[model samples]
Target: MNKAIVVTGTPATGKTTVAKAIANKLNLKYIDVNSLIRTHNLSEGYDDKMKCDIVDTDKLNRILKQMIKDSDQKLVIDSHLSHHLPKSYVELCIVTKCELKELKQRLEKRGYSKAKVRENLDAEIFDICRNEAKEKGHNVIVINTSEGSKDIDDVLEEFGFLKQFEA
Candidate 1:
């Protein structure tokens, strides 16, 4: 069976970067669900004035299922709502984390407002993504990304993706 790895975390936690690195190293297809949502204009009122709300779970799951079915190789799926998707399709679920102050600084540098940064920090501290993974019965791996980009590679190695045959 083709494996699917779900990389999820609070905003600015380097989920996208990690997902891309893992995909490249493993020769897996990288699918950023957030980019899919944006490219297809699936969400309502996703304009500059509106902060992006979570997409409908059913719709998101449907899209993800279709993507998985269409792919011929393993997939690295990155999204904030990966837990909401079907657990049976996911082989591994990783939640990227970072120090609150560092996360705030990164988000601020990305032009996020104080309120948005605070919300994300709270979510990370409370282990929202980890909780969701637990509830979904996913094998969860939590990685802290505050130090630098190398942490992502370390995570992939820990998950055995860096090995040629393990992936």
Candidate 2:
């Protein structure tokens, strides 16, 4: 777990949950990209229509690259924007997905406005994150996090994270 891993996907698609679980299991540092953006003043402005920050992706990537270079601890970077990072800086890029119905429910539960919900739902429906990650030449893995699929530990095992524990 010494290398950097990024968990990226549409909001409410379980990127945070999966990233945090992987970080905890592997003893990696969990870097929340949203917090990083705020802390580093990386936002260009606020997107009123989207109800979110309009970040400078190049700056974000530069800062993240520097952070990865400077840290001794491994990192699990979590955000829908994280997949924008160049592949050379990451060991793995995980893209989470959820059923559209489940994703809509999750977004509504978060109190997102209808427009925001629709935008994010469209992103998920288009597989935007996964496609972008691959387009960037990342070593990518897609995880279906829809309800009743697989739990975190099972997913980890399936990905060979617990190989040493197997009989």
Candidate 3:
């Protein structure tokens, strides 16, 4: 069965909300990768310009691989960087997306600085995370969270989990 799932995208793209929903519905272990990074001291430092942690993807992947190796339950990993884990380690990669206007509102509502907001908007404009996930060879799904057009059940069905959940 598909086991490791990574939820990733530009900030303000509904990654956390969707990831948590999937985990709850599937009875999977929800792993907040940002929390794991802090817990494991995986960040090299903070990026003042970006107003975020400077995570070493190599270190993060190593730790994630270990966690996957040690776990028996399926994992729903949540983070913009979670897609960095090798395709071999992830059964599915879900890239959350938001409309540019909606995303701008979300970032501003979150009290992000103008620069940070612009940076994220640009990332979304260019499909950075999705492209990167694909470049890494992951089995990818694009979820349009802006419209909420993709149902959680439909996503599960697409991932071939509908049969698993049926009694």
Candidate 4:
């Protein structure tokens, strides 16, 4: 798992939880893409309507590539935007998904405005992240992360990550 891995999907699909768990299990560095955006000033602007940052994807990719080259430590990058990264820089890309009903409830619980909730829900239903990762030529895996399901670990193990990291 020395190569970079991306955990991405709809906004409320539990990317952070699954990514962090993988990072912890494999002793990889967990890279929070949101924090990286803020820290590196990779913001294109603030999306007032969506209440989200408009990231400069090109710049984000460049910086992330450099970060990967600068360290030997494995990285688990977390963000819905992470799938946009070039495939050459990523070894595995995991997309978290949840049932639309559960996904909607999760998004609503996050206190997002109706429009924002609808937007994220649509992204999930349409499998936006998964499609984009495939288009980017990434080796992608999808996991159902509906509420009370922690099957992410099983998915990782099936992908050979757990065994690869066993010491």
Candidate 5:
């Protein structure tokens, strides 16, 4: 059975960055759910304020399931609600996190409005991603990205990804 890693977290938490890095390092396929949604034009809203609201969760879930089923190699999935997907299909689930202030700043820099930034910050503070993972009975690993010195390798090692090196 192929292994899969789900990189989940609130918006602007660097899930995409870490997922991409992991994919590159491990020679795994990187799947950005948000990008897939946009590429397929599956979203209902497109404006700055309503972009997230436009996402059809059911359709998104269906596409993700299909992708998971069809993947021939290991996959690194970057998404906000990755934990909510079928847990049996995921080999590991990682929830990336960061300080609210930094997350807000990152979102703002990315052109998100104040409302969107605050919403994401609030979600992070409330531990929405972590809660979802726990609810799904997944062994979720929390990675804090608040400090600039911490890299993906550090997180991978902390999560025991380096155990493969010993084999």
Candidate 6:
């Protein structure tokens, strides 16, 4: 894995889970964007209505690029904001998706306000992450976790990462 991969999608769609799994399987570094924001102070402020921090994209992109350059390891960037990074920095962009019914349940389980749930659901329905990744000119892969984790293994194999284990 010589290139960085980004796992991005609507919140609670298993972006972090799938990203970490890919990192572990492929021996890539898992870079949590949220943690990076906290450490680098890239947040402009909290969005109380959304219950999330508003990260400064320009600063975050600089830090992430530097981090990628500084490390020898291939990275799996785990964030919805990850796709906003320039396509040159990413080799593959993965968007996790779930069936709508299950997605709604998952959102509700997070105890988000009804409005938040609806907002996130709408984002998913509209394919925000997938569309953005395409617009950014990334090699995009969409995984429906509601289907199975088998697709993850296929992705790793297709990308030539599984060969290291065989070696």
Question: Each prediction's Cα lDDT score?
Answer: 0.79, 0.87, 0.86, 0.85, 0.79, 0.83
Error of 2 at 114 (Å): 1.3
State how far residue 62 of model 6 sits from its true place (Å): 0.9
Return the TM-score for each candidate structure. Answer: 0.87, 0.92, 0.90, 0.91, 0.86, 0.89
lDDT of 6 by residue, 1-167 (tens): 24578899999888987898788786778999998888878889998888889888888888888877777788889999999888878888889998889899999998998888999999999999899999999988887777755466665566574444221
As for TM-score, the candidate ahead, 3 or 6, is 3
Over all chains combined, what TM-score does candidate 6 have? 0.89
Off by over 4 Å in 2: 161-167
Clashes of 5: 0
How far does residue 124 in candidate 4 sit from its true spot (Å)? 0.9
lDDT per residue for candidate 4 within 35-141, as digits (tens), equals 99888988888998899998878888888888888877878899898889888889889899899998888888888999999998888878999999999999998
Tens-place lDDT per residue, model 2, 55-155, is 98999999999998998887889999888988888888999999999899999999999999999999998999999999999989888888575578778
Best by TM-score: 2
Candidate 2 C-alpha error for residue 54, in Å: 0.6
Stretches of candidate 1 exceeding 4 Å from the true structure: 47-50, 148-151, 161-167
What lDDT score is found at residue 70 in candidate 3?
Answer: 85
Where is the poorest 10-residue window by lDDT in model 4? 158-167
Query: Which scores greater on TM-score, model 1 or model 2?
Result: 2
lDDT of 6: 0.83
- Any runs in candidate 6 off by more than 4 Å, and if so which? 149-167
For residues 44-142, write the lDDT of model 3, one tens digit per residue: 888887899999999999999988888888888999999999988898899999999999999999998899999999999999999999999998988
Worst 10 residues of 5 by lDDT: 158-167
Cα lDDT tens digits, model 1, 1-167, are 56588889888888888888878887788897878888766786543432665477688888888777777788889998877777888888878888888888898898876677778889988989889888999988777888755656676677674465244
